[model samples]
Target: MKPFYEKTIHTKPIFQGRMISLQVDEVELPNGQTSTREVVKHPGAVAVMPFTTDGRMVVVRQFRKPLEKEIYEIPAGKLEKGEDPASCALRELEEETGFAAESLQLVTSFYTSPGFADELLYIFEATGLTQGKVHPDEDEFVEAQLISLEEGLELMAAEQIHDAKTVFALMYWQNKRLKAQLGK
Candidate 1:
Protein backbone atom coordinates (compact mmCIF):
# COMPACT_ATOMS: atom_id res chain seq x y z
CA MET A 1 0.00 0.00 0.00
CA LYS A 2 2.99 2.31 0.00
CA PRO A 3 3.17 4.82 -2.85
CA PHE A 4 4.39 3.26 -6.08
CA TYR A 5 5.67 0.22 -4.29
CA GLU A 6 7.54 -2.45 -6.19
CA LYS A 7 6.98 -5.79 -4.53
CA THR A 8 9.87 -8.13 -4.85
CA ILE A 9 9.01 -11.36 -6.53
CA HIS A 10 12.41 -12.98 -6.18
CA THR A 11 16.00 -12.08 -5.37
CA LYS A 12 19.16 -13.78 -6.64
CA PRO A 13 22.46 -13.11 -4.94
CA ILE A 14 25.10 -12.00 -7.37
CA PHE A 15 28.30 -11.47 -5.48
CA GLN A 16 29.26 -10.98 -1.90
CA GLY A 17 32.28 -8.94 -0.90
CA ARG A 18 33.78 -7.65 2.28
CA MET A 19 32.01 -4.32 2.20
CA ILE A 20 29.15 -4.82 -0.18
CA SER A 21 27.02 -7.46 -1.76
CA LEU A 22 25.23 -7.45 -5.11
CA GLN A 23 21.84 -8.92 -5.90
CA VAL A 24 19.29 -8.90 -8.66
CA ASP A 25 15.67 -8.64 -7.62
CA GLU A 26 12.63 -9.37 -9.76
CA VAL A 27 9.80 -7.07 -8.79
CA GLU A 28 6.20 -6.46 -9.73
CA LEU A 29 5.65 -2.79 -10.42
CA PRO A 30 2.70 -0.80 -9.16
CA ASN A 31 1.10 -1.07 -12.56
CA GLY A 32 1.63 -4.89 -12.67
CA GLN A 33 4.67 -4.76 -14.88
CA THR A 34 7.55 -7.00 -13.81
CA SER A 35 11.18 -5.89 -13.95
CA THR A 36 14.54 -6.55 -12.41
CA ARG A 37 16.51 -4.32 -10.10
CA GLU A 38 20.23 -4.75 -9.53
CA VAL A 39 20.90 -3.64 -6.02
CA VAL A 40 24.00 -3.02 -3.95
CA LYS A 41 23.83 -3.83 -0.27
CA HIS A 42 26.17 -2.12 2.15
CA PRO A 43 26.83 -2.32 5.86
CA GLY A 44 26.54 1.47 6.10
CA ALA A 45 29.27 4.03 6.84
CA VAL A 46 30.19 7.12 8.79
CA ALA A 47 31.86 10.38 7.77
CA VAL A 48 33.27 13.09 9.96
CA MET A 49 33.94 16.77 9.46
CA PRO A 50 36.61 17.62 11.98
CA PHE A 51 37.73 21.12 12.86
CA THR A 52 41.10 22.26 14.11
CA THR A 53 41.35 24.69 16.96
CA ASP A 54 42.25 27.42 14.46
CA GLY A 55 38.96 26.70 12.65
CA ARG A 56 40.39 24.95 9.61
CA MET A 57 38.60 21.88 8.30
CA VAL A 58 40.52 18.63 8.39
CA VAL A 59 40.49 16.56 5.21
CA VAL A 60 42.21 13.53 3.76
CA ARG A 61 43.72 13.05 0.32
CA GLN A 62 43.44 9.47 -0.81
CA PHE A 63 43.32 7.51 -4.00
CA ARG A 64 40.09 5.75 -4.78
CA LYS A 65 40.48 2.74 -7.04
CA PRO A 66 36.99 3.03 -8.45
CA LEU A 67 37.64 6.64 -9.48
CA GLU A 68 41.23 5.93 -10.49
CA LYS A 69 42.27 9.21 -8.90
CA GLU A 70 43.11 10.91 -5.66
CA ILE A 71 40.48 13.08 -4.03
CA TYR A 72 40.20 15.16 -0.92
CA GLU A 73 37.52 14.04 1.46
CA ILE A 74 36.67 14.35 5.10
CA PRO A 75 37.55 11.42 7.32
CA ALA A 76 35.28 8.43 6.77
CA GLY A 77 35.07 4.68 7.07
CA LYS A 78 32.75 1.71 6.91
CA LEU A 79 30.77 0.70 9.96
CA GLU A 80 31.77 -2.55 11.56
CA LYS A 81 28.92 -4.95 12.25
CA GLY A 82 26.58 -3.60 14.90
CA GLU A 83 28.81 -0.58 15.34
CA ASP A 84 27.42 2.68 16.63
CA PRO A 85 27.63 5.43 14.03
CA ALA A 86 29.06 7.91 16.53
CA SER A 87 31.78 5.48 17.54
CA CYS A 88 32.57 4.75 13.92
CA ALA A 89 32.76 8.49 13.26
CA LEU A 90 35.25 8.99 16.04
CA ARG A 91 37.28 5.95 15.02
CA GLU A 92 37.50 7.14 11.41
CA LEU A 93 38.32 10.69 12.48
CA GLU A 94 41.19 9.42 14.57
CA GLU A 95 42.43 6.77 12.20
CA GLU A 96 42.43 9.00 9.11
CA THR A 97 43.30 12.39 10.59
CA GLY A 98 45.16 11.33 13.74
CA PHE A 99 42.90 13.52 15.76
CA ALA A 100 40.44 12.84 18.55
CA ALA A 101 37.41 14.99 19.08
CA GLU A 102 36.37 16.10 22.50
CA SER A 103 32.94 16.72 21.10
CA LEU A 104 31.15 14.77 18.42
CA GLN A 105 27.73 15.63 17.03
CA LEU A 106 25.68 13.80 14.45
CA VAL A 107 24.63 16.00 11.55
CA THR A 108 22.48 13.64 9.53
CA SER A 109 21.97 10.17 8.10
CA PHE A 110 21.20 9.61 4.43
CA TYR A 111 21.09 6.93 1.80
CA THR A 112 23.93 7.48 -0.65
CA SER A 113 22.17 5.89 -3.60
CA PRO A 114 18.60 4.98 -2.94
CA GLY A 115 17.87 4.03 -6.55
CA PHE A 116 20.34 1.18 -6.85
CA ALA A 117 22.00 0.92 -3.47
CA ASP A 118 21.11 0.75 0.19
CA GLU A 119 24.26 2.44 1.44
CA LEU A 120 23.28 4.52 4.43
CA LEU A 121 25.79 7.12 5.54
CA TYR A 122 25.90 8.98 8.81
CA ILE A 123 27.59 12.36 8.91
CA PHE A 124 29.10 13.90 12.02
CA GLU A 125 30.74 17.16 13.03
CA ALA A 126 33.68 16.99 15.40
CA THR A 127 35.07 19.92 17.38
CA GLY A 128 37.76 20.38 20.04
CA LEU A 129 40.08 18.01 18.22
CA THR A 130 43.49 17.04 19.61
CA GLN A 131 46.24 15.67 17.41
CA GLY A 132 47.67 12.22 17.89
CA LYS A 133 49.31 9.67 15.59
CA VAL A 134 48.08 8.57 12.22
CA HIS A 135 47.18 4.88 12.04
CA PRO A 136 45.26 4.04 8.91
CA ASP A 137 44.38 0.52 7.94
CA GLU A 138 47.09 -1.80 6.63
CA ASP A 139 45.99 -1.30 3.02
CA GLU A 140 44.90 2.32 3.28
CA PHE A 141 47.13 5.20 2.32
CA VAL A 142 46.05 8.76 3.03
CA GLU A 143 47.49 12.19 3.67
CA ALA A 144 45.68 14.51 6.01
CA GLN A 145 45.62 18.30 5.85
CA LEU A 146 43.61 21.30 6.91
CA ILE A 147 41.94 23.87 4.69
CA SER A 148 40.12 27.14 5.11
CA LEU A 149 36.61 27.77 3.88
CA GLU A 150 37.90 29.63 0.84
CA GLU A 151 40.33 26.81 0.08
CA GLY A 152 37.52 24.30 0.40
CA LEU A 153 35.48 26.26 -2.12
CA GLU A 154 38.39 26.37 -4.56
CA LEU A 155 39.07 22.65 -4.23
CA MET A 156 35.38 21.89 -4.69
CA ALA A 157 35.33 23.90 -7.90
CA ALA A 158 38.46 22.08 -9.08
CA GLU A 159 36.86 18.74 -8.29
CA GLN A 160 39.63 17.79 -5.91
CA ILE A 161 37.04 17.88 -3.20
CA HIS A 162 34.64 15.47 -4.82
CA ASP A 163 32.07 12.94 -3.53
CA ALA A 164 28.62 13.71 -2.17
CA LYS A 165 29.43 13.41 1.52
CA THR A 166 32.36 15.81 1.43
CA VAL A 167 30.46 18.29 -0.70
CA PHE A 168 27.53 18.10 1.72
CA ALA A 169 29.84 18.75 4.68
CA LEU A 170 31.28 21.79 2.98
CA MET A 171 27.82 23.14 2.27
CA TYR A 172 26.73 22.49 5.83
CA TRP A 173 29.71 24.40 7.17
CA GLN A 174 29.11 27.29 4.83
CA ASN A 175 25.44 27.47 5.72
CA LYS A 176 26.16 27.34 9.45
CA ARG A 177 28.64 30.19 9.13
CA LEU A 178 26.22 32.25 7.07
CA LYS A 179 23.42 31.69 9.54
CA ALA A 180 25.62 32.79 12.43
CA GLN A 181 26.66 35.96 10.62
CA LEU A 182 23.01 36.75 9.78
CA GLY A 183 22.11 36.31 13.48
CA LYS A 184 19.78 33.46 12.73
Candidate 2:
Protein backbone atom coordinates (compact mmCIF):
# COMPACT_ATOMS: atom_id res chain seq x y z
CA MET A 1 0.00 0.00 0.00
CA LYS A 2 2.81 2.40 0.77
CA PRO A 3 4.35 1.69 -2.62
CA PHE A 4 1.17 2.91 -4.34
CA TYR A 5 1.06 6.22 -2.53
CA GLU A 6 0.97 9.49 -4.50
CA LYS A 7 3.02 12.15 -2.82
CA THR A 8 1.87 15.73 -3.15
CA ILE A 9 4.47 17.85 -4.91
CA HIS A 10 2.62 21.13 -4.84
CA THR A 11 -0.88 22.49 -4.23
CA LYS A 12 -2.45 25.45 -6.02
CA PRO A 13 -5.55 27.02 -4.61
CA ILE A 14 -8.30 27.58 -7.19
CA PHE A 15 -11.03 29.00 -5.05
CA GLN A 16 -11.75 29.60 -1.38
CA GLY A 17 -15.14 30.16 0.18
CA ARG A 18 -16.65 30.25 3.62
CA MET A 19 -17.70 26.59 3.50
CA ILE A 20 -15.42 24.93 0.97
CA SER A 21 -12.30 25.45 -1.07
CA LEU A 22 -11.05 24.08 -4.37
CA GLN A 23 -7.44 23.18 -4.96
CA VAL A 24 -5.36 21.44 -7.56
CA ASP A 25 -2.46 19.33 -6.45
CA GLU A 26 0.53 18.17 -8.41
CA VAL A 27 1.39 14.69 -7.20
CA GLU A 28 4.19 12.25 -7.83
CA LEU A 29 2.41 9.09 -8.88
CA PRO A 30 3.58 5.67 -7.75
CA ASN A 31 4.72 4.91 -11.27
CA GLY A 32 7.23 7.80 -11.26
CA GLN A 33 4.85 10.02 -13.18
CA THR A 34 3.38 13.38 -12.25
CA SER A 35 -0.33 14.20 -12.38
CA THR A 36 -2.75 16.84 -11.22
CA ARG A 37 -5.66 16.13 -8.90
CA GLU A 38 -8.52 18.51 -8.30
CA VAL A 39 -9.81 18.42 -4.76
CA VAL A 40 -12.50 20.06 -2.70
CA LYS A 41 -11.57 20.81 0.89
CA HIS A 42 -14.27 21.19 3.51
CA PRO A 43 -14.47 21.85 7.22
CA GLY A 44 -16.00 18.44 7.95
CA ALA A 45 -19.36 18.13 9.65
CA VAL A 46 -21.50 16.18 12.13
CA ALA A 47 -24.82 14.39 11.71
CA VAL A 48 -27.14 13.41 14.55
CA MET A 49 -29.60 10.55 14.56
CA PRO A 50 -31.88 11.71 17.34
CA PHE A 51 -34.26 9.12 18.76
CA THR A 52 -37.15 10.07 21.00
CA THR A 53 -38.35 8.17 24.03
CA ASP A 54 -41.20 6.65 22.00
CA GLY A 55 -38.81 5.13 19.40
CA ARG A 56 -39.27 7.88 16.85
CA MET A 57 -36.41 9.46 14.93
CA VAL A 58 -36.14 13.18 14.53
CA VAL A 59 -35.49 14.32 10.95
CA VAL A 60 -35.44 17.62 9.15
CA ARG A 61 -37.24 18.59 5.95
CA GLN A 62 -35.69 21.35 3.91
CA PHE A 63 -35.20 22.53 0.36
CA ARG A 64 -31.76 21.79 -0.96
CA LYS A 65 -30.91 24.29 -3.68
CA PRO A 66 -28.54 21.97 -5.46
CA LEU A 67 -31.20 19.24 -5.62
CA GLU A 68 -33.91 21.78 -6.45
CA LYS A 69 -36.40 20.00 -4.19
CA GLU A 70 -37.17 19.28 -0.59
CA ILE A 71 -35.64 16.29 1.15
CA TYR A 72 -35.65 14.73 4.57
CA GLU A 73 -32.39 14.14 6.42
CA ILE A 74 -30.82 13.85 9.83
CA PRO A 75 -29.80 17.08 11.47
CA ALA A 76 -26.30 18.04 10.38
CA GLY A 77 -24.02 21.05 10.09
CA LYS A 78 -20.43 21.87 9.36
CA LEU A 79 -18.03 22.04 12.30
CA GLU A 80 -16.70 25.39 13.32
CA LYS A 81 -12.94 25.66 13.29
CA GLY A 82 -11.55 23.59 16.17
CA GLU A 83 -15.02 22.41 17.22
CA ASP A 84 -15.44 18.88 18.58
CA PRO A 85 -17.74 16.65 16.57
CA ALA A 86 -19.89 15.60 19.54
CA SER A 87 -20.52 19.22 20.43
CA CYS A 88 -21.43 20.02 16.84
CA ALA A 89 -23.84 17.07 16.75
CA LEU A 90 -25.62 18.20 19.88
CA ARG A 91 -25.82 21.76 18.65
CA GLU A 92 -27.19 20.78 15.25
CA LEU A 93 -29.75 18.43 16.80
CA GLU A 94 -31.07 21.12 19.10
CA GLU A 95 -30.90 23.91 16.56
CA GLU A 96 -32.60 22.10 13.70
CA THR A 97 -35.00 19.85 15.60
CA GLY A 98 -35.60 21.66 18.85
CA PHE A 99 -34.62 18.56 20.81
CA ALA A 100 -31.68 18.25 23.16
CA ALA A 101 -30.35 14.81 23.82
CA GLU A 102 -29.56 13.50 27.28
CA SER A 103 -27.34 10.80 25.84
CA LEU A 104 -25.38 11.22 22.62
CA GLN A 105 -22.88 8.65 21.39
CA LEU A 106 -20.48 8.77 18.51
CA VAL A 107 -21.45 5.98 16.12
CA THR A 108 -18.88 6.49 13.36
CA SER A 109 -17.19 8.93 11.00
CA PHE A 110 -16.38 8.78 7.30
CA TYR A 111 -15.54 10.90 4.31
CA THR A 112 -18.65 11.63 2.31
CA SER A 113 -16.85 11.49 -1.04
CA PRO A 114 -13.21 10.59 -0.92
CA GLY A 115 -12.70 10.42 -4.67
CA PHE A 116 -12.76 14.20 -5.03
CA ALA A 117 -13.67 15.79 -1.72
CA ASP A 118 -12.33 15.69 1.81
CA GLU A 119 -15.56 16.36 3.65
CA LEU A 120 -15.77 13.93 6.55
CA LEU A 121 -18.88 13.62 8.70
CA TYR A 122 -19.13 12.38 12.26
CA ILE A 123 -22.35 10.50 12.97
CA PHE A 124 -23.92 10.32 16.39
CA GLU A 125 -26.84 8.49 17.94
CA ALA A 126 -28.82 10.65 20.33
CA THR A 127 -31.48 9.37 22.73
CA GLY A 128 -33.59 10.67 25.57
CA LEU A 129 -34.59 13.80 23.72
CA THR A 130 -36.30 16.80 25.35
CA GLN A 131 -38.22 19.26 23.21
CA GLY A 132 -37.22 22.91 23.16
CA LYS A 133 -37.36 25.96 20.95
CA VAL A 134 -35.94 25.63 17.45
CA HIS A 135 -33.26 28.17 16.53
CA PRO A 136 -32.31 27.32 13.00
CA ASP A 137 -29.82 29.54 11.22
CA GLU A 138 -31.38 32.62 9.75
CA ASP A 139 -30.72 31.29 6.28
CA GLU A 140 -31.85 27.78 7.13
CA PHE A 141 -35.48 26.98 6.50
CA VAL A 142 -36.04 23.58 8.02
CA GLU A 143 -38.95 21.79 9.67
CA ALA A 144 -38.48 18.84 11.96
CA GLN A 145 -40.52 15.66 11.80
CA LEU A 146 -40.70 12.59 13.98
CA ILE A 147 -40.93 9.17 12.33
CA SER A 148 -40.46 5.58 13.32
CA LEU A 149 -37.44 3.69 12.07
CA GLU A 150 -39.66 1.65 9.80
CA GLU A 151 -41.07 4.81 8.30
CA GLY A 152 -37.60 6.18 7.82
CA LEU A 153 -36.61 3.11 5.85
CA GLU A 154 -39.73 3.42 3.77
CA LEU A 155 -38.86 7.00 2.96
CA MET A 156 -35.37 5.92 1.94
CA ALA A 157 -36.80 3.36 -0.42
CA ALA A 158 -39.02 6.06 -1.88
CA GLU A 159 -35.96 8.27 -2.52
CA GLN A 160 -37.31 10.96 -0.21
CA ILE A 161 -34.38 10.52 2.14
CA HIS A 162 -31.51 10.81 -0.29
CA ASP A 163 -28.66 12.43 1.58
CA ALA A 164 -25.69 10.17 2.24
CA LYS A 165 -25.22 11.12 5.88
CA THR A 166 -28.87 10.52 6.71
CA VAL A 167 -28.94 7.24 4.86
CA PHE A 168 -25.83 6.03 6.64
CA ALA A 169 -27.18 7.12 10.02
CA LEU A 170 -30.50 5.34 9.46
CA MET A 171 -28.78 2.19 8.29
CA TYR A 172 -26.53 2.26 11.31
CA TRP A 173 -29.55 2.69 13.55
CA GLN A 174 -31.30 -0.26 11.91
CA ASN A 175 -28.18 -2.41 12.15
CA LYS A 176 -27.97 -1.66 15.86
CA ARG A 177 -31.59 -2.70 16.29
CA LEU A 178 -31.08 -5.95 14.38
CA LYS A 179 -28.05 -6.74 16.46
CA ALA A 180 -29.97 -6.12 19.67
CA GLN A 181 -32.80 -8.36 18.51
CA LEU A 182 -30.34 -11.13 17.71
CA GLY A 183 -28.55 -10.64 21.02
CA LYS A 184 -25.31 -10.05 19.27
Whole-structure CA lDDT of model 1: 0.94
The local distance difference test score of each candidate is: 0.94, 0.93
Misplaced by over 4 Å in model 1 are none
Per-residue lDDT over 1-184 for candidate 1, one digit per residue giving the tens place of the 0 to 100 score: 5699899999999999999999999999988999999999999999999978787999999999999999999999999999999999999998998999999999899999999999999999999999999999999999999999889999999999989999998999899889989999
For lDDT, the strongest prediction is: 1
Q: Candidate 1, after superposition: displacement of residue 137 in Å?
A: 0.2
- lDDT of model 2 at position 73: 96
Alpha-carbon shift of residue 72 in model 1 (angstroms): 0.2
In Å, residue 162's CA in model 2 sits off its true spot by 0.8
